[model samples]
Target: MSYDPSGNAFDFHGSSYVALTPNLRKLGGEVEWDNATKSATVTLNGKTATVRMAEESVTVDGVQQPLSGPSLVKDDVLYVPASFFRDVFGQSI
Candidate 1:
């Protein structure tokens, strides 16, 4: 993960975590952030995943799914679970 002065990137429970923007891009997804709602819209492969900070619920392709972990925000950067790509995008890590 790239360094962020804001301290939003780190490792937890043996999983590496980074800010949402980079994670989205790494997954080949386009992201639109909504600061007001503290949510992110990620689009890839004709699917949309809407995730809200501090929420365990994610909407993928207009269907709601329970997340293994909540989406978190620290220092204004959104942090998603490391398994997000595998869980939400159907990709192996």
Candidate 2:
């Protein structure tokens, strides 16, 4: 894994993914972890999204969408597909 000011980035299946927290923070979003469920809840602009590890789908604002790949948790850090920045959060990556 490699970290930039943006966040930790790594290659998975030839695509790049990034650590979720820093980018979410940068977007002014709040992230809450649910260790019991192995998931994270992200809220931004009154919208909430739930992402879980080893899952190919996520729920955004109570709606489910196909995730590009499974989310991953490593050493307490959450890594999400980079497309998540643009596709789900409406942030330019």
Candidate topping lDDT: 2
Candidate 2 — which residues are off by over 4 angstroms?
Answer: 1-7
Q: List the residue pairs that clash in candidate 2.
A: none
- Native-referenced Cα lDDT, model 2: 0.83
Report the C-alpha lDDT of model 1 over 1-93, residue by residue, as the tens digit. Answer: 344566446665555565777767776879998889878999877789999988988999889998767777777788877677777887644
**What TM-score do all the candidates reach, one by one?**
0.77, 0.87
C-alpha lDDT score of every prediction, in listed order = 0.77, 0.83
Native-to-model Cα distance after best TM-score fit, residue 51 in candidate 2, in Å: 0.4
In candidate 2, how many Å is residue 41 off? 0.3
Relative to the unseen true structure, what is the C-alpha lDDT of residue 45 in candidate 2, on a scale of 0 to 100? 72
